[model samples]
Target: MATTTFSKLVVFAALVFVGQAALITKPEGPTIRTRHGDVRGMYAEEGAIFLGLPFGNPPVGELRWKPPRAYNKSWAPEVRDGTVPGPACRQPGCGPNKIDYRHTCNRDKNRTQSEDCLYLNVFVPRSVLLNSSLRLPVICWFHGGHYMYGTGSAMVYDGRILANKTNTVVVTTNYRLGVFGYLVTGEGEDDARGNYGTLDQIETLKWVQQNIADFGGAKDKVTVFGQSAGSDSISVLLTTDKTTDLFHQAIMLSVPFSITHKTQLEAIRVGNDVAKSVNCSAGDMKCLRSKPADDLIVAQNEAGKYIANPFKPLELFMQWGPTVDGDILPRQTVDSFANGKIQKKPFIIGNVREEAVLYIYEAFSKPMSKLELDGIMLAFLHGKGPVALHEYNPPKASDYRPFLSHFATDWVFQCPTRNVIRNAVVNGENDVWLYVFDHVVSIKSIWHHKAYCQDHVCHGEDIPFVFQTPLLLNLSFTREEQVIADTMAYHYGNFAHTGDPNKASPNVYTTGNVLKSPLDWPRYNKRNLFPNMNFTTPQSVIVKDYNKEKCDFWDKENIYSARNKGK
Candidate 1:
């Protein structure tokens, strides 16, 4: 009798173990259905990631230089793999895959890339698949590489961590670049029409609107964010009606507003120069289109060097960018905003305190003398070098590069951005918030620290902290740096959910992270001139106009006029 009882007890224990095992589910990739078909995406503890999804048809062969063709969805209900990443658009100086992304793009490397690279990646919370009803905010980040370099798939921009941390859907998209995307020949249809890249961005946003709901994203709550050239594109979109109903708010970082959209005539001259360099007959659109892609890219590299600022000495800036067609762009960015063509939405635009240091620091062998600084400043300030020099006499730092960095930062980034926001505020448009990133880390400490930023925060330094990519990359982050990463992500996530960046609640991302400050970020006002946020370690503070005297001089003197710069 005892042996029979023991046998029954053992069988009952085995059943209980099996039942518990069934309750603990294993991790498996999820599949979502779209208009085309179903796509299987990778699932991790971080988020559900869908990668390498093409939103536009291949813009190759005859479709080159045209607006993004519609995506062909002629598939049955079979599942496609979204685990692999797509190739980045063809451009020089792009770095290798899965390693360091901020390096030179195609520097003597046999990297995997091609012209057919207009794709995007999406990331959502891991639990969204289980709870299909959970609708989250969306963030579409436009990768910035001077509009000529970079891929949305750079590991640093992988959206899994950001999505899981913020409880939002994050998107990174690829657009055409350089001559392939922006080469303009005065003629419209058969030849190069400009703004194809911007159009590509718009198309991606449209796709997000149409399909993001299936992936649990709030279609109406989409926000577009970018750095550098991406910000410039956002600035252009703000003035145009092309992006209506696609995205609601914007976050622009380090907007170089001084680079106005080129008019058709101005663009024609530049385009003609590129054509001539490629050995094509004048107005022979057929011959230009027939050339191989690489040959055209080489031609652009050879002749794309002579773009000049008539009033200044800045060269090789934006030769091929947003062109102001009479129909699309209509006019330069500032004119459109001043005429109240702005879409009237909440925005955040800012720049680093030392914006230009990263560009000029390594080019110099010795300390940059004041005379040399004045020479460089002339390129940006034009004939107003002396006036600016008198106003921003470099403080006695241990090094002199900061002075040169300061001069260009003010004219190109700081002052112009301030003027742009001021126009919005004075017009009684939607809210405008300003910030200046003053955070700095030591080169002796952080891995992959560029020689350009020794003790200073160069341009786009806020990206890593905001995305928390350093953690994803396993780079060492001190306690303070970790806090900074948390703070930026929290505020940015807040902005995507609500228009306000600092209306913070609990920090579900980290135990120690908290964002509700004693004071809310004051909006930009013309009368009282309230202070702006200073993003730094220990804690950020509000400060009244940084380099106020110089910014005032630049605005009052009208030194930033595109007419003077030969726009």
Candidate 2:
């Protein structure tokens, strides 16, 4: 209670776990000795990239559907080659919202996918080798896929630019997905309990605490970050007391606060449906386990038909993800933040201006009429349809499904997250920075997505700029795009370095006057009406309550809390 708002409950977990590391001579020639084993990484212009480092043992055979086991470091090989990315956990190859890392943009389909995919990648700045006393901050990224697809190994998630530009270690980790990750037998702790992915993330963070120091990262300065499902996972981690020792700060980007964590019974029912789909009895644990991974994957996809009711008014979220088990996540995520049960730590939580454009663009066969838009608002809010329609009014209908996406975006993503941020700052005395990403990148043209953007910025448009991946990957970016990218990297680097994004501490980028209004990012406390930074190119300005009226309307109707109980 006596500590400042920036941090509290600082960890000694790294000290206790890393006692033996100071005893061993650090590895030579771009290699580092982890508590588990020695890993040799490849050098890059930005930093040293250590790829496919298994943080957990393969979740294969008997280990499937169980809590992740620490990577068996006692292997015969003392030195592990970490240049190649580990196989992505077994997943359905292609879908509307999915990106097959192997065949993205219709590239080669040669990359492998497997159940034995519990690995992570680390990117450390090359400069770290010069100073043995220097300990840099770390940003551990969790890739988003509705908690059902994608991997850390994906090309867009390459951590090189972020590490090099930010002067901090960047880690991207892979966790189980879909039925493989979230299945529960309702058999309690002994059998298949859901949250394997969340547990894997916790284990992977533990691994980071033990080994990151060898790669020039400070274990105590680890900040876990993610977008979408990954952000949702961080939202869960904030609620769980067990993960307190693994992280110091947080950066959540566009959390779908409306998404519900599955109840134990709901998860068990879904698992039962999976078992039945695979021709195994509800209680046939062995049969389910023995089934081929691909068969299980198919069954998993098939099981979704039952969980999400298309005939129903709306299906706003994924059916499989973090479950509220008694162990890992004991309570609803939003409820935890609302009740002030979350750890009081600095946080940066923000959403995009158009978070739901892609959803509307992809799912709809034709553009919605104004009448249809009103119907959706009604369905999403149940009997409060007229009120929502009145609040989210659009005068003359545009070519696009004008108001539908806006309504869905605020209802599902923006407002609820804002609630958590304000709650943390106002109630728990935590420093919370808010932002709205309004930048539109040209990389969208290169992507194979069905969506188009003349003025719209889709969900995750902020990422390429954050990492400067387009420049690194040889994808073309306009001169302005590069500048915006630098601006983003500077802010993110500053945040990773010091808990505050506005203050550049250990990580400094001299962008003097290049960015308009490149100054203080005000905290969303009780004061100042919670003004937010609008992250667009050229200049980033502060806006008061960014989407105040819409968010307030939802708050008045209790839309945010209602979704937690709905699905």
Candidate 3:
């Protein structure tokens, strides 16, 4: 009897090994027929597969900076190992420094970067793709690193979590950054032209439309979502007529449409100044193009000191953002939205309660006084400081000035997000849902020096929660926090799958006195600004006005300041 049992066990073990081997090796070289050619990818894991395919011809040498052309059909079969990520676009800096100034201008970590970095990665659930009948929704992400740095290869943006949790196809692409992406030389030269980055994105969308179906995705059910500059790009795409058919829905995490023509030109002048300082002829595009990438990056960083908001200057070398090129952007995003020309689609847009706290934390060590706070209001509000003062009076105590940063929060981020919602409802285009993330982790000590007291939900803090990546990075979360992440991810996935977020059904989490129902969150009409949905402890919706009048006043004042340009 013992001998017989041992033989049976050995047979079972052999069967299990064979099944595992087959599962790992069976799905090898799955072919995908694209508009360009028949390319192949392979299975990466149990529920994930990746394809690193090129969507356009390499924009290098003579083709550099020109609008990306279609991939040539006559080209030979390039043996692509889709398992490896591609190089990022030629740009300055590395890692998070790609967005912030952690390195010197002389540093050229990205000198090895290639202009040929137009590759895109697709992450799909193997189960969905293997089942030919299942047509999953696709989420195409654009990474955010100030439009100058960041790549599809960044680990934080790995779509595995998104695909596994949401059961959808996820894609991330690399586009031109920095000088290669948005250097606008007033001359007719290709290098001087702006919006190259936007064009690269459009091309990737085109690729999705053509090849996504092969990966068991509905080409028509594409939802473009992004954060920070990526979110800014989504806003632009929604406004641009050229991208109307490329996507059906958009999720903008933190959109900022602060760029104007005057500001963009100033940025160009900064590039020219850098060129001249580096001994390259400012007038000669060829000479500037020939300069070493590192030297040019150093010059650009040196020139940043002369402009306010060096990363996003109003009218100088500091401005590095999308331009209203007549072909790609055609007009400012705000103007297009206000004119009711933007794509009519359901949108889910909101910001952290304390966004400016992050910026203030990075810039200053101390809090602002009531007088200094009034000055800031006046600067953004164009003499409407007194009205703002009446609405949002500073805390009486000087020690509580740190709390005043919330005023900056509402003025810059929260207010603008609410404005977008208001405009959408007022225009009668689509339904809009508003959320205020008030969940404050006990990590306040981590931000002690930034003066970010209270439960200041700073910018970009919601990303990890939304992606459900707390454990992957060894971050701790309570059972309740895990529930919030699950709920948020569920809603996001449902939104991408369908035009309406209500399809997710029964939003059981609420803050304040608000109840979690499929239709309880009313449209944000002016009459009822209370009952804003809060994501915090007890999860109840409550009727509390978040000083909307003060926020609106600041918005109008900023618009006026933008228009009048007082000397």
lDDT-wise, the better of 1 and 2 is 2
Clashing pairs in 2: none
Q: What is the C-alpha RMSD of each candidate to the true structure, in Å?
A: 7.1, 8.0, 7.3
Give the TM-score of each candidate.
0.88, 0.88, 0.81
Least well predicted 10-residue stretch by lDDT in candidate 1? 1-10
lDDT of 3: 0.62
Q: After superposition, how far is residue 322 of candidate 1 from its true place, in Å?
A: 0.9
What is the total number of backbone clashes in candidate 3?
12
Model 2 agreement with the true structure over 432-506: per-residue lDDT tens digits: 889888877666554454545446777877777676666655577776776667777777788888888878764
lDDT of each: 0.73, 0.74, 0.62
Candidate 3 structure quality by residue, lDDT tens digits, 148-252: 777775655667667756667889887787767776766465456777788899999988887788667788889898877788788878877788788888777
Candidate 1 overall Cα lDDT vs. reference? 0.73
Candidate 1 Cα RMSD after full superposition onto the native fold (Å): 7.1
Instruction: Show model 2 residue runs off by greater than 4 Å.
Output: 1-29, 75-78, 94-109, 308-316, 394-400, 510-517, 563-567
What lDDT score goes with residue 140 in model 2? 97
